[model samples]
Target: MMTHWIKSNSTVFGKYLFVKGLSQKVNSKKFEVGKTVFQSLNGRDLLSFEGYTRNEVYSLLWVATELKNVQQSLRLGKRVGLIWSNPIAKASLTHASQNLESSLCCVHENQLFGSSNNYEMLGRSLASTSDIIFLDVPSWSQSNVEEFAAGSNRPVILISSRDLSPAVVYSELLSFYETYGFLRRVILVYLGPGNNPALNTYFTVFPTIGGHLRYVVDGVIESQASWEKGLRLATKFNTEIKQFEKVDEAIDRAHAISTCSHNLSHMHLKLKDVKEMDLDWTFVQSDSHKGLSVSKDLMKAAGHSLIHEVINNQSWIFQACIAAHTSDYRPIIQPPRFEGVD
Candidate 1:
């Protein structure tokens, strides 16, 4: 019963990017997709090539395993909706979409390696499999959403970057988003000028009654990852609510450490040109019906340990990936979008 109120253009979580980036760099030079034989590498290839290397293998495990933990931490719970293109993108998203909480939409299904022309055929099948759907905002249309909405239960939708205001589309079908028993999460990516009044003006149309809305702004990764590796990072911040109903012993165990400064507003974030630091994160308490807050200094301190948590959580996801590898390669298409539907 947790929800993430994230807004921004780019926000990715966990150390998966660091490991995957390093692996990609190595694999880019070593393995050449179809050209390099699976057995050619002397030890291991970090980059993903179909299903051949340790990096690729473990990466999927990372997604299937760590995703659940991270989302649960944010209270996205067991069901999530992820939007990214390709198998690599699909696998990279493991951290957020793990277990049954995640549903994926390949926005550029037209570009999949072995894409098929039977668009509706794949669309109908995808509708049957997932409870929610994710789509690039520009590509989403009213007709397409309605067709899938016809089949889904508590479905979710995603729109990449603010290129297309969600209002134009959602305006036509306010009822779709407000459907009974459905909890749709709408994510808008704000790369920069994230606070444009034009976009904010349209916010009122989106119903909060049965949906979750988040603005995603990118945040600090490690200084090294952004500069040295050409990596992209986003904040995977968390909030802890003090529960009044919990046992007294547990309450006594809870503690908060104040930092030397409220650096929450400013940190010597590196590669400023290459990154965006979101200064605030909000936490909600269900029982108290009140909001809690944390300082930037506290965020910097707590976030420092993400790498360790990521490493420790890997073993189980890896096992799960290995078991599901063969069957996981099947194609999962996003339902088709209609042409020129307002």
Candidate 2:
């Protein structure tokens, strides 16, 4: 049956079986067998495993397949390493390991809170291991991706925020390239909207391969203050109460407005910190997680904004900021409490 599945869906089933075979062997190997075992499996090995009805073999196969996909994605002509910091380091590592096509390596606890040289050494060691290195350090200013790239042969990618500013962004990119030629691409992931408009304008001023900019509107949108009162008045008075008439009319007008425009306006407002007092009108609102919430209206608006940004700007690298606060996004995956810098 497994063989038949492989023959029918060779692309999918073959990968599935290969992953299964690797899991069975990983328990015995001390070194990283994930990359190796996946490469070894072929049709013959898969067919042999299928002959045995052992549930263990089946379970191992499932894990192997998933890991294989991740490995292949990471090893596709580019070695990618993810660096994390503080509380977010672990979660980011877990997510990157599962989702990104690259190996996830965290900064050591001792090195994290140590001297600048220690951090530099750690970054160098990590850069040496892969073609692409993602530094999840707290402040991009303190990070030394360029130092690591001095000895590295691959590209170094840094994930940072809007607070870093365009000047900081340019300085880092220039320093990396000048110091170490390996800093081919610097991908900045900006999270705050505090200076998004200015940041957007700044990136447009210097659009180049050396530094690619991406923005993330990282916050939730809540319903307008009037929404609750309007709901209550409508429920209590129905159409008979003249006092609630204006509320009803406002609700109708809000509903008539295109949901996309409303959501987009909401996003801009949230980013710009636009308050109810500033708005002459009101619209329905709800809290969204990292990206748009599951609502069709909000999703469309989010998608439209993303598309517009990408088209207008070159190398706009936008992504959902899973970590809440700036400090929450740490780069060191595992470190003792004492080792963390304030």
The top-ranked prediction according to TM-score is 2
How accurate locally is residue 84 in candidate 2, as Cα lDDT from 0 to 100? 50
In model 2, the worst 10-residue window by lDDT is: 318-327
- For model 1, what is the alpha-carbon lDDT of residue 252? 33
Q: Judge candidate 1 at residue 2 and give its lDDT.
A: 31
lDDT of 1 at 149: 42
Candidate 2, TM-score vs. the true structure?
A: 0.30
Q: Write the per-residue lDDT of candidate 2 for residues 21-107, one digit (tens) a residue.
A: 321111111111121111111111111111222222222222322332323332222344655543333444445444433345555
Instruction: For each candidate in the order shown, give its overall lDDT on alpha carbons.
Output: 0.27, 0.28
lDDT of 1 by residue, 217-240 (tens): 224221222122112111111111
Which segments of candidate 2 are over 4 A away from where they belong? 1-79, 86-102, 108-111, 115-119, 142-145, 151-153, 161-342
lDDT of candidate 2 at residue 235, scale 0 to 100? 24
Backbone Cα, N, C clashes tallied per candidate: 16, 14
